[model samples]
Target: MTESGVAAGFLTLVVVMGIGRFLYTPLLPLMLTEYGLRTEQAGFLASLNYVGYLAGAFAAGPLCHRFREFRVLVAGLLISCLTTAATGLSTDFVWVTAARLLAGIASALAFVAVSGLVLLIVARDGRENLTGLYYGGVGGGIVLTGLAALPTARIWGAGGTWILFGAVGATLSGVVLLLLQRHDEPRHSAATPRATLPWHPRFARLVIAYGLEGFGYIITGTFMVAAANATVGPTGAHLAWVVAGCAALPSAFLWSTAARRWGRLKPLVVAFFLQGAGIILPAALNGAAALFAGALLFGATFMGIVTLALSEGASYAPTARARIVGLMTGIYGIGQIVGPALAGYFSARTGTYHIAIFIASATVAAAGGLLIPDAFAHEQARERR
Candidate 1:
């Protein structure tokens, strides 16, 4: 049942986060062409989704506490699937925008709820290492999106492709429900103290660094397919996304394993630097090779970073894991909301993404640099102890 619960968490992420939330990246170029949407408009649309995500993330902790994580997860999954499917029902920019907004909320609810549940389950079983596997679903769903996007768009148009993704999400959600059936909810006694966010310097650094990550990585994530198509054509664009997804698929597990050896901070710092380099590659070089390589690096790091950061955040307040995750996720969502919009504005006006891409790369590198102090502080503290 524990393994089953873990699997359920994985599948839920694939459906809500992968298919419902991220499917937009693969379909963005298609949406642009099909709907006559400009780059700024597209960016605004993406930002709207993140806005909803931010709201949902802020609400997740309280909702979970009031209703239980299991109930929240179920509601989130169903709504996410419905919203994903609804995205196909219209080409009107406003209608699609509304769908994306609702989908974002649903995805965040599911994300927070399932993450807390899975972490609780694994921690209880002394298998917290499997947290990485649960996060692998994000990459798995991305793979499905990359593999399915072009073919389905060709056969069914962008609108129809969205409907198909919705159907797929719904089917996967069903499996998640079955696996999580009658799942035990962690109950707190009335006397148990409420979990509060710590003001530790390390925790603050972690949250700020994650916010920077949200600001930086999202530009590449949102525009990679479009950028690839502009430089290398549709086939190359699809291939690049697929390569990214494949790289991401094993990254969380691999990075967590590395952390178990070298510790989370070093691996995280290294990943931030690597991801910074990746963000600059495709924007700097003009070739399918550069795009593919960038995709590989980006995919390999983002989910791993999430796994590491969340695990570390949990360590700060084990009793308030869900609250911390929600807070971080909400901050991250704020960065996401701003990133694409600004990137789009610069790209559309300059007719190149170079400026925005360079800025994003620098921001991510700064996040890495910020963590160095925290690492040193931790080492000194540990030695003293």
Candidate 2:
């Protein structure tokens, strides 16, 4: 049951998050080429999705409290599959925007609900290490979608490709439903006393740093493929995204192991720095190799950052893991909301994503600096005194 639950949760995220939510990253370039969308418009559409994601995050808190987490997860999966398919049914910007927005909301609900359930299941079974495997589903989805897009784009074009992805997502969601049918909701014994971890300087720093991550990563996350297409060819862009997915697949596990050996903060600090470097590579060098290397670095660290940051935030308020995670996700969502549109707008005027990528890299580096040992050491000393 334990393994099944974890596997179900992992596959659910792969379908909902990987395909439903993020397939847009690779598809955005296609939309620009075959469809009639501009760079700025693509960014706007992406921002709308994030806005919907923020709404879904906010809704999940209350929805989970009122209903079963399993139901919410399933509903989210259904919604994501449907909306993803619906995106292909229209070329109208408004319709596509609305579909992406709803997909965003569904992806968020599925993500939050599944994450909580999986964590609960793992914690109960004492298989905490498996959590990395569960979270790694997002990367798996990215790799799947990126690789699939290469051939699909040639055969199907943008509209048909969206439909194809939707079909794939629906099929996977069905598999998840079957796996989770028996033990969807695991009951908790008793509630832990809510810890009142007041907002300290360190906590504030963590939140700010996480928000910076949202801003920094979304630029590349939203436009990396598009930028690669501009610099290299279509094939190079697709390969770059695939390389990113490949790098990302094991990132959570690698970072988790590193955290155990070296400590969470240090590993996270390094990840941020590496990610910053990754974010800038494509822009700095106009070559396929640089773009692929950059995507690999970006893929390797982005999800790792999410896992580490959320875990660290939960540690600060162990009794209120859901609340802490929600707050952090909301903050992160804000950064996402702003990033793509801003990048798109600047890129439209400047005719390149270099400036936006540079800014994003700087933001990521600053976020990493905040996680350095000295930054928190001073706070710890102050707390002791």
Candidate 3:
């Protein structure tokens, strides 16, 4: 693959997966209105996507040992893209739920498999210099979803808008698929060994932190728009996501650039704390500006965690990296699976989303604390050989 080929393939893969993620909030209110859903009802359906994703996350590892990832990835993207488009065509909540569930599962398969592969591919050259180009998908999709939502907000309702975006994504996937040279992109590094099943103790701690982050980050991200709506009214919801998207555009660059200089663990710890503060701040202040800033912080660091985690796991015994990532991702998926449901439960009790956000902040703070001992001890343990 040419440099341009890598860029195109990586971005399309990320965007296809990211669409499953960013689609919800932009479409949530529309789903609620179109389906006449209760808050919990909507939430349950939304959480179902995570459930499917969790299942997919677990399967990616074993499959990695068996299949070529780019092939699997292309298949996953095609399925997800089709599902997203189909989800749009549905009129009822059940149909939408089914589509989202399938989309989530397919997207997860693509996400975990490609991510595991990308980590392997990038580590080969020692540069991974264009890493930001890969993550740019999140920011790009955020912008795409946000911008797409605006035009359809008045005309087509939620389902129609989802269909539109889904069509766009699916169509783009075909173009991207055609451009990719399947054999060229799959790089099994010479320095790397066959992926093993389990890892040392340090992997467990990192996995826990990732899970907590999944729980913590989504608690706020799930409800950030609602908070913005309550804070500055309707405009705030749009602005909040927009700010998150705008902030995200530069985040991969900023964090990845820093990781190059500062190394992964400490920079990641600081990033986690910053993210925690972001999740907590809007809850405390409960205003438009605060929510916007919080969204920005989240945008800046959210993907950074995954970047660090992927890179960190890659540095482990080469034979163990995929399984390590798979396990850690599964743990994180558990957190995502639980986070929104907990937030919904808390919101129902308190009649405000702030408490949930605060809880999320606490979770992130705790995750950060775990890294303190993890950072130093992990290195010392590695050196004991």
Candidate 4:
């Protein structure tokens, strides 16, 4: 049953995130050519999606407290599947944008609910190491969706591809629902006392660093395929996305292993630095090889950073885990909201994405520096105690 629960959660993430949330990245270039969307308009749509994500993240905590987590997950998956299909039904910009926004909201709800449920299931089974496997579902989705793009595009253009992805998401969601049907409804207990850790500078640094990550990583995630298409061609772009997905698949487990051996803070800091390099590589150098390398690096670390950062945040406020996660998610959502629009604006103004990518790299590198101080501070605090 625990294994089934984990499988259900994994499939839920694959549908909500891989198909509903991130399919946009691989489809953006096609949308530009087929639908005639400007770079800025694409950015606008991405930002709007993030806005919906922010709202959903904020709502998930309260909603889960009030209702069964499985119910919330089902509702989110349903919305995501429907909205994703809806994107294929129209060429109207307003309709497409609305679908993306709603899909984003659904993705967030599903993500939060599924993650919490999976963790609970893992804890119950005493298989904490499997946590990475649960989160790896997102990368699995990325790879599957990326691979689906080519054949889908060949058979049915951009709109057809959207419809196909929607159908796939819907099917997967149904499977997950079936797998989870045996689980009992979750019950809420009395709230625990909040941890009384000092409002240390390290905590603030973590928040800011995470927000910066949100800003830095998203630029490449959003536009890498588009940029690659322009520089190398369609094949190269597809390869880049696939490479990223492949690299991302095992990254969580690898990072988790490193964290256990070296400690979380050091591993996280190194991840930030490596991810910064990944974000800049394609922009700084020419050729398909460079782009692919960048994608690999980016994919390898981005999700790992997410896992590590959230764990760090939870450790800092163990008694208030949900609240802290929500707050950090909200901040991260804000960074996502700002990143694409900012990148699009600069791309439009300069006729290149290089400047925006450079900015993203620098911001990520600075975030790494922020973590260094936090690591040292944490060590000192521990020693003093």
Candidate 5:
């Protein structure tokens, strides 16, 4: 495949994962009455999906070294489609959960493959710019589903929505696999026999921060659409997602431009603030405007934060970009796995998502502030040297 083809593959991969993954939240109300689920139970089932994703992230490097990335990518998508479609077929909690877990694993494998493929197609300078465009597909998928699937839920119900995605995912899996560009071995290939990196102090902090973003962001991912619906009623909630998806569509360009002018930390700090403000938007004013603004703020900055922070993290050890990013991705996945559980606990205790959402809001706010201290410290060290 050409560079353009590869970029399209990455976009398709994100869209497929988006379809199989977060497509559940807006349709949760139907799942609630259709399946007899409490709030905590519903949240727990969502975590089950992330659990599989966590496992897949950790396994990506070693598995690729053992086998081949293209094969892994194709199989993962096939499994994800089957599992996601089957998820709607069973109204039972256990069966629904089992399907979700499998779907998560499949999504993770394809994601890891596509991320690695970026370097194969684009050069180092271009990687930072491409990161947002690649990941932006997640938001794009949300927009597509929000506009289309939410309406489908009212008509054919959740089963039909899931069934449609299964076909789409299966088709894309084959298409992307065939379209994958042939490239030389990745320079930073973790699968290479000689590849290795010893974790250091600065890199450790970057990893921790990235995981924190995961902890904070997953709350929005799990509940943003639900919160919007609850705040202003269902008719407008899907439109809030439209705001998010559209805002997210351009985030890659916005963040990348900022990073280019001001440097990585500056844009990342701004992103954290955007997310924190957005997360708490509902509590301040429970209206359609507030919710829509929140979704736009959250969606616009969330993935860009991941792109900038992780790209900076990888630079600290450029020789191992794929592995280091994969490791951080796994750690981030762990935070996501825990995020839903924490949200579930708070929802159970307070009988609302407010406590959980606020907890997330505070976390990103602090993370943004933490970057200030880090910048000062780095400057001081440079002066002393």
Candidate 6:
């Protein structure tokens, strides 16, 4: 892959997936404090975003085929920026809800578009390993969110912080547009055969495990900072978030390298189990130290899982890049939609996030368990074949 293509892909992820989608996590506490937003309402709003993301993932493949990745990616980024900014325009729950929903759709579009493009490019050059670097943008964006929110929330409140992130996202989007100006976006060729998903048992297993991962990880991703803030104050909470981001930034690259050395399936199984442990740590213990340790594990494993799963999926259907990606992402989105809503309902009633956290951890452990057969038995079977 060319340097510019890599840079553009990285920055696109930073703008959309990082700032547009995940900035909500660090800002959740602020919204709760500023607008008297209830936990259930927050969960609903988050689920709405994932709902839109599900819609967007389903749409991304068709849109890319119809409009090309460049146009779709650019449009998604712009819409993401606008929707993020719109959140600051009103304190009304309805308004913020709409904003978050729209942001989710835009984020999914941009995320899938760029991922397809980058994966296609790297596949041509045997640089599939660089996917780690490409996905690291999300962590980079999360770190920025954590850092910026501290002063911005203190100075102008949650509304101002939202507006500021919107502006920053827009600026970065413009940079991505420029950086990618020379890179050729892939065009679907009429001569190429239409791509279809293979009806393989391994792919089925992967989809189920990935869906479970989506259901399991999002609870911690959405609420870890808030849970920490409640336990250790705002400063410590943000610090924990930053720590997660720091671990996240290198995780994709490191995990990718490990997969290259150790083979993909075993490493993937390890990541899933490690992530399960990470998700439960803070809930099992208390204090800043526990939170930070959990944050490191959470950050380190989530993107690594993404890098491995998506790459593995791509290998399964090389001819249908967008379709396979959209399918996996669409399933993942469903899990995301369900996780927070249930977590919020239970937490709000019981007055602690402990129940939700424990369930999430167990769900992730189950996901890891689902992959063990593939990691061992199936791998040996495939090698024999």
Scored by lDDT, the top model is 1
Show the lowest summed lDDT stretch of 10 residues, model 5. 182-191
TM-score winner between 1 and 2, please give it: 1
Report the CA-based lDDT of candidate 1 relative to the real structure. 0.89
By lDDT, the candidates rank as: 1, 6, 2, 4, 5, 3
Evaluation by TM-score, superior candidate among 2 and 4: 4
Residue-level lDDT of model 4, residues 1-385, one tens digit each, is 8888878877887899878878888888888988889999998888888888888888886677667578789889999999988988888999999998998889888887777677667666786667677777878889997888877887788888988888999899889989888666456644733335436777778888999999999889889888899878887798789899888888987887876676678889999999999999987888877888899999999888987887677666554445566667778888899999999999999989999999999999999999896666666447423
lDDT of each: 0.89, 0.83, 0.72, 0.83, 0.74, 0.87
For candidate 1, the TM-score is 0.97
Better of 4 and 5 by lDDT: 4
Give the per-residue Cα lDDT of candidate 1 at 203. Answer: 90
In model 5, which residue pairs have backbone atoms overlapping below 3 Å? 1-181
lDDT of 3 at 77: 82
lDDT of 6 by residue, 115-153 (tens): 888888777777777889998998998898888887888
Which ranges in model 2 have alpha carbons more than 4 Å from their true place? 182-198, 373-385
Q: What clash pairs does model 2 have?
A: none
lDDT of 2 by residue, 73-112 (tens): 8899999988988998888988999999999899888887
Clashing pairs in 4: none
The parts of candidate 5 lying over 4 Å away from their true place are 124-128, 182-191, 376-385
- Cα lDDT of model 5 by residue, 1-385, tens digit: 3455446655565545568887877777667776788878878887888899888888876665566566666667788889878987878888888988988888787777666666445554454466666767777777777788778888878877787777777776666655664454353344456357547665676677778888888888887766666677777877777777778767865787777777677678789988999988976777777887788898898878877876677666555556766788888888788888899888788877888888898888877887766545766335323
TM-score of each: 0.97, 0.93, 0.91, 0.93, 0.91, 0.96
- Arrange candidates by TM-score, descending: 1, 6, 4, 2, 5, 3
Tens digit of per-residue lDDT, candidate 1, span 109-169: 9999999999998898899788889999999999999998889999999999889988998
